[model samples]
Target chain A: MDKLLLLGDEALAQGALDAGLSGAYGYPGTPSTEIFEYVQHSKEAARRNVHRTWSANEKTAMEEALGMSYTGKRALVTMKHVGLNVAADPFMNSGITGANGGLIVAVADDPSMHSSQNEQDSRHYGRFALVPVFEPSNQQEAYNMTFDAFALSEKYKTPVIMRLVTRLSHSRAGIVRTKYLNENEIKLPDNPNQFMLLPAFARVKYKNLIEKQELLEKESENSKYNEYHDGKDRSLGIITCGLGYNYVKENHVESKCEYPILKICQYPLPRKLIQKIIDECDEILVVEDGMPVIEEWLRGYLDNCLKIKGRMDGTLPRCGELDPAKLRTALGLEPYPIKEVPTIVKGRPPELCKGCPHRDTYYALNEAMKEYGPGHVFSDIGCYTLGFLPPFNAINSCVDMGASISMAVGAADAGLFPSIAVIGDSTFGHSGMTPLLDAVNSKANIVAFILDNGIVAMTGMQDSAVTGRVEDICMGIGVEKEHIHVINPLKGHHEENVKIIKNEINYNGVSVIIPRRPCIHIAAKLRKQK
Target chain B: MKKNIILAGVGGQGILSIATIIGYAVVKVDIYLKQAEAHGMSQRGGAVESHLRISDKEIHSDLVPHGRSDMIISLEPMESLRYFPYLKPDGWLITNITPFVNIPNYPEMKHLLKEIKAHKNSIAIDGDAIAKEIGSPRSMNMVILGASAPFLGIPFNMLEDSIRAVFGRKGEDIVQKNLDALNRGRDFAEEYIKK
Candidate 1:
């Protein structure tokens, strides 16, 4: 009964380990990256022979996990919400293929775009995939539901989606030790018909999925994961799901009689539970972290569901993670005001570190583009995006993982002045290679900046494709040997680096500017370990 | 009664290790437990927070409310103040009073200790000095965490166990040093804190 202090993401990984998962595959993304990283580092997980690795990207990760599940081994795929978009091809198709083992897809949504490009809800993906989705209300439930999700996956022959928001993924809570199950044997499909995805087979599987919807709803209605806590308050009924439910229950723990509550952790729109809340209370308030999917459904299900109020009704903001203050306001509790202070924490936005190599590289790029004017820089995702802050403010665009190179090419072809693309080593591998190839073949005038930090730097220094060899990749992408410039991004030689950037910017053909330096954090970690 | 407290800070500031010590030690007096942390983007010096919700009864909500937290333990002054809306008016705030230069806004930083000192029951400790005295500035978060121990109602040995649990695997020498840092902060708080 020893308690281990766990991050919400780590707890989910440990929960998968405790639940007897055979393997975990994922691509690193904010809020969800630690799930696989923790699994990779855990002695218990390793002792049980759990397979853990960072896949090429989210799609490869999802497919690899699906392949493991096909062999009748419990496999968990972890990814940030947009990672679901990358994996959507395999995700939407997996429902038709079906799973042999317990397959759980844990999607961590970053509402308010904290560290992500989008604040998408993966629950919609779950609904689209026709798989039952499980959202934990807290860390313990994150553990329990992860364990239960594996069972549900096995029982229904469908991959279960476990959705987490930034609050749920990053938060910590006390979790009781549960019985651990270690299953190493792989159970292959008994019938080949399950793997065959011919149109006939897919149609049959699709129909089977349709028939299983009732079972999913039944499982949700009868789940130990989802519950109806009878409270004292019947007038202002509160129906909350996921972490939003936790906020409601804790703040109004004493007001049980006044507020009847239906707490949902598992999904497929538990209509029966919604009905119970509607029938019991005069005014119902539906609280959820993101989107009004359930609340929207309940309104139609039970004659507008007793004057429904929630995010849709402006009872809660339709965006961002929901906390107790927002919940308290929805329930008519006294609001807590933030103390008015003259000078609090300084509003200094994040920038490259003092000795960061990216700093000099960005400085060079900015100087080279002085004649080109602004909006000519298309940047990729990484620590280099911090260049958009103060002193530098060099990057004009940062859309997604590897949009910089392609966007820059299009802009250059459209006759933009000195269009340059700056992406990190990790991001270049993630999705930059294809665009770089396109630029090479089309003979575009865009200059691509590959900031090689020898690691993923932004997502905790995990390994990347170009981690060890950036020079070779640029050369392979058909950059002229003379134009493929590799320079250390340190201070005192910022002017020389800027001169190199100017030469490349002036080049009317494809060019690659390689800024070489170790990330400050990574260098320190290496030094400490040594 | 059980009170759930959340301590948040930037990565290199030792937030996780400090939370571990508090989690291990608090269990001895209260039915305390701490969850394992999984920070994805802490590598880029991103903001990180750990939830330590301890209570007399079992706690279901792992996250502390925006304004209902009993205490906000911070290693970096800015990180502590960033989550200031989460702290209750009557709650305690303990932070390291070091001035980290704002690199982008170079040569300019508004001091936080003066404003924090004027707030209710807030105490700023020389966590860096205590940690250095214990042979590591990396242990500064533990010092600030230790400053909140007595206020948290957790026994000394309980914290010692958490300290031991986290650093136990690293080495015995590190465990002793971090524990020393924790005690040094505790002693400083005991002598200087008015509340």
Candidate 2:
């Protein structure tokens, strides 16, 4: 096959294809969303009828992947790091239950809270699941590992996690070509006892899981994934994992006469590899992305005697992703001469696209809230959350999906005047409606802004649950027909919409604002059709 | 031979597209390849980074460590600087001179330009200008990608094929525009060397 350009997510999808995966399951989330989207959209996948769909959420996605693997098919499940929290229950159990087929779960972690609620590392989840985790530093690894992970999963009869961070999930890289169209064998579980979780069965499985730890450790020992290069000089050794290694190697700042490197990609911590590198060098600098799991592990295993240094010891900061310059400084190399940068361009701070329905909705909201004296809006995660930024600044808080309506109700219960919740069509379906029902039943004086962009725009516009049933769902939730205000967001109806909103704000009960508009991105995309 | 290349940029900058095209081009050359990218928060105006590893032999790991990359290609200047630590001492940096201001701190950006100019082994091109000259500023990504192609061992024709594959039916106009931008970038680099 010829080389093809692939998104980090698409490359992972291709990697899964190369890895002989039979299926993939996931819900859309930025950074991690594209993998499933690609799997769903790829011509090769479609022709082969590979089982790819956006599962309702991460939990279902994981279980479905598990189901496919239970039938002895290779499966890949992916989600953003936070989505793993939603699927953590099954993820933990999959280890104890074991796998009948090859299973790879790719979780893309977001550090620095880019499009996520928190910068949490998903590797911790893999550690918790007691499964081997593979973190690829670049696109080629992303592809190769997706394929390699399946084999490892089936060989070990345990699900493997391929963890990626934002940098590694979305970045592009040059990768050499190999054969394609590989698909895994489909097999069925011979013993129902393997998946059954009754105490008798689960207890035995748990013990097996415990015993598998040693097997996993042993696998890590001779595993080709755990490798080291014997530097001619072994004074100051570098041990790096994932993209952090790329950052280190890019500078070639490794000490010529001092540093040997132990590059760890497979986990359960390859203790032998770490020990060998540590013993060969006077000082060990551990570089890994996100948290210092490796550093902390090395510190504990070496009893802090190895002069092990990394993020935990203030040699590196506890937060933010790292770059090569920082690694150079850590390696005691001269800094690259700083280049004269042109003045950074100050472009428009991103907001909802102009003429977007959310913009009109917020305009009406800001107008109606003049009497309320501001600080009344609660928002949820969507493109509309850009309402919190200036020009709009209409939203007060946006913590997570489905948080807006409930947060608004809480504010109203706490005696805040004219409380308003701004949520999108998809978020309302994800978790927003129950709070609206709660507010209606409790007679809370809150207005919920249901900005219907007709899709889940924040995560690349996957289908929204309420796309067709918004009205019935709202009505069923007890929102009064009279108070359900529907208005086009881009139309010049802010004054009338403001009047309706003010009327609802004074209603002393729950009100629903259905600001309907197409997302500009989606709209433009659709318009190109005409 | 093992080569590590890093690509860095802000979200929505088309850096990933450039990287993907390059990844495809490299594979067309029949080398063992491992690559990964960072996204997620990137869609929210955050920085994005990607790592590319090309080898002649089978690869066990997908990641490349610090100080080992042969080159750094940045679609934006500050983003390139952000990944500066990854570049080898003799490594090449290919970046567009286009600027993005309002990073979290360093309110006075005029002074930041001085810092960028002081860097060594940096090849900065007015990719935005080239894109505008060829067509859209969005094509700046392709221009910067074109500037780095020769040094990265990717042929322009291979990249064009990848572009066509990705863009599908839209490949005709997009490929032509991007090709123009790329040629302009290559010409600029050639002219800079002469100077």
Task: List the per-model TM-score of the A chain.
Answer: 0.95, 0.92
True-structure lDDT of candidate 2: 0.76
lDDT of 1 at A167: 76
| Candidate 2 chain A: worst-modelled 10 consecutive residues by lDDT | A339-348
Winning model by TM-score:
1
lDDT of 1 by residue, A1-530 (tens): 77755667887888998888889999888889878899999998778778886787888889999999999999999999998998999999987777889999999998767788778788888889898999987777788888789988888889899998887787665566688887747778888789788898889889999999999999999988778887676777788888777787767666553577788889887778878878888888888887777777667655544478888768899878676677778878877766543344545444566788888887777777887688888998888888887789899898988899999989988998688899998889878888998999999998899999888777787887767677788788787789898887877778888888888888898889888878887787778889
Instruction: lDDT for model 1, please.
Output: 0.79
TM-score of chain A of 1: 0.95
| DockQ of all models, two decimals each | 0.40, 0.23
Q: Residue by residue across A1-530, what tens digits does model 2's lDDT show? A: 55565656677888787666788888788779888888888787888889886676788889999999999888889888888887889999998898988988889887666677788887787778898998887776678777667777888789998888876676544554575646756567878678898999999889988888888888788777677877876667889888777767755633333458788888888878887887788888888888888777668754648488888777777777776667767777776554232445333344454456777787778888877677888898778777888777787787877889999888899999888888888878877878888998899998887888888877767887678678789899898888887877655676788788888888988888788877876887768888
